[model samples]
Target: MQEYSSQAAYDRGEAVCVIGAGAAGLIAVKNLRENGFEVDCYERDTVLGGLWNPENQHSPLYPHTHLVTSRSQTEIPDFPMPDDWPDYPSAAQMLDYLKRYAAHFGLAEHIWYGSEISHIEPVEGSRFEIVVKPAAGSAARRLRYGAVIIATGHHWVPNLPSYPGQDGFRGTILHSSQLKDGSRLRGKTVLVVGGGNSGIDIACEAAVNAAECVHSVRRGYWYLPKYLGGEPADYALARLQRRPRWLRGFLTDRLLKGHRELSARMGMEAPDHKHTDEEPIRNGRYLEHVGDGSIQHRGEVTRFDGGEVAFTDGTTVRPDVVVLATGYKPKIGCCPPGLLGVDGDSPYPKLLARMFSPRVETLAVAGLVEPGVGALPIFHWQTHAIAHWLHIRKGDPERAANFRQQVVSESAQYAVDSTGVSPRHHLAVDAEEYLAGLGRIIDTLEQEPAK
Candidate 1:
């Protein structure tokens, strides 16, 4: 066994350490490099696209997974996806786009694949000591950096729920990530549990491929088609935000009215929040499948009995397979929870401006928030702010102090109303409000430095 030591770390002066080589980490490296900072990004997986790459063992992608948000909104702000691609690109296309982005920015050279950041500690004067754990037989090495950015993302750890008789159930049970091949559903009675985008998409897949498909959702959610009035749904809805406040609501209602009524007519419960509050389901075929009776919409699972499953609504299903499409839990295991301001019992980090760490000056988390839109653009602006903040803090002390307060105030505007108790909702934020706050932070950083 390799002996662990607390020896002095080799310090790389003023270089930043980015955890994970996923989309967020790639963007962080590119943006930080653009800001004249040396960046070293680490990825546990061999690939660079993070969860988007199906080859990644931790990827949450299931059969036929596609982007829910339109391409125009999903692409990185500085790097746009190919215009010829479909509005809602598939998982494969998204991985390709990320690869192209890394290549275009020459970011691959800086990334250390198969290297994971096992631990991080704050050292003298805002610097960080990181332990890089190699994927193979190589001994761990310790290094020091001026700062660290946690871009590991929240989609890796699966959130598996248990029922009363789950241990005794005889049916084949699988998480969403395990059902990568659609052929797994062919000719089998499949029960897809959860109301999130993954569940709906998988249920739709099962509807066509399986002998029977039953969808179990605990609560109601806003179901949106991929398009509205001949345009992509997210694009169409986002455009309404630019309109007059009085006219916006009316226009949004008009666009969503048909889908809302259709969901109600199909016996689905009304959503507790507005369409914009949370990520609305964006698959057009899901509702049509529900309407045609191909996908049976049911209530939450209460228990499992032998080969049968019982729901809260008194309905039971005998399925050949049970697929839990419940989403992932937000986890940052490489560092201490207290460093991320995770106080007493709560798992969610209380980040300043939803990016910067409240307890550590040189630590920040990228792409941790669910901004109800294309996440890549949000990550771009987030890393942009983070890079600029680190740059400013290094030189202009007085301006950096002022900018800190400005970030706190700006972040106050995007407080999300949490209606769901699921751990998945912990990171939810209003995209419009968050983008505005990020813009303000960027403006402060971009301002002229002291004379």
Candidate 2:
């Protein structure tokens, strides 16, 4: 392999391992490699691009799939997406882009594919041990790293909250994960549950072929168009959004107003959920932006009957099939509790600003922050943070310790973050600003001394 950007100063044994080769994981790998760190990426699948790879086991890529966010905002920092690719890249395009990235940087050899990580726990201070088993074999092997990153980004499992009478439904029901094509729903009445992007997309597909379609959401959502004018809707807001929080909120409000009809038609109501959910969007024109009167908007599903979906507002719709797009639960259980050097699910303080494991400062996690402006932007920022922290520890441990001291308190209450119903705990930082801050930190550390 070619020599890294920093060779002699690079720390060995202090090898870092990142799980999953998704968008965030790949970015993390690139940054760490640039710092001359010996990084190993363990991927459960045989390919790059976690959800983008369709042939891998239980991956996400369907004929109908297209990037919800535009290529400009979603691409990695150094590698600009190919000029020939569509403005909104497809899943296959993204997969190819990642493959190219790995090949260009000679990262494929460093990756151990088809290796499923079964468990992870902290060992001695500043170190972690991971138990991994090959997908085709029965044998398990233990590998230790200076730090292990759980870039195994979310969406691994589907979230199906238990509700009344779900078992009573006689017709076939599938989660968004299983519904790869709209062919089966061609002549059937379909009811889509949820208000997120996936739900919106699924409904769009079904309306094209289904006998009829209904979109059900608990409350209203403000959705942004994928594109406005010729660029991404969120791309235009980049300038106006840099203002103070109050001013940013004003711009957010104006964008939602433009998409109100489309949002309402797609089962997204007004007031509570602003268009684009306050996320930045590219302004582009779309046909049938509204539910088209073909996809009816019904607020929330109360329960299910033999052939009926009841709602919280005492309304009910009889549909042939229902597709639930509820989100997923973060799976930290696979990792041991003591990994944090503390007991419980709460994140560690005083370590890479609560981005890495404090118990094992070498260990880091990317893609944990919930989507701020979709998953890619936030995950990109997280990957950047992990990489910067690794560089600091590699050059000088004492200097890094001082920086770690700044984050000793992760929460205002010194309380641990839980997965329960709380938005603030997950989305503490503005994602775009966080990425910008991350870039600045890397630049700063590159100039800082080893003292």
- Best by the TM-score measure: 1
For model 1 the local lDDT of residue 420 reads: 82
Encode model 2's per-residue lDDT on 130-155: one tens digit a residue: 77768898657677778787787656
Model 1, residue 308: what's the lDDT? Answer: 97
TM-score for predicted model 1 compared with the true structure: 0.98
Model 2 lDDT, full chain set: 0.66
Candidate 1 Cα outliers beyond 4 Å, as residue runs: 1-3
Instruction: Assess candidate 2 and give its TM-score to the true structure.
Output: 0.84
Cα-based TM-score, every candidate? 0.98, 0.84
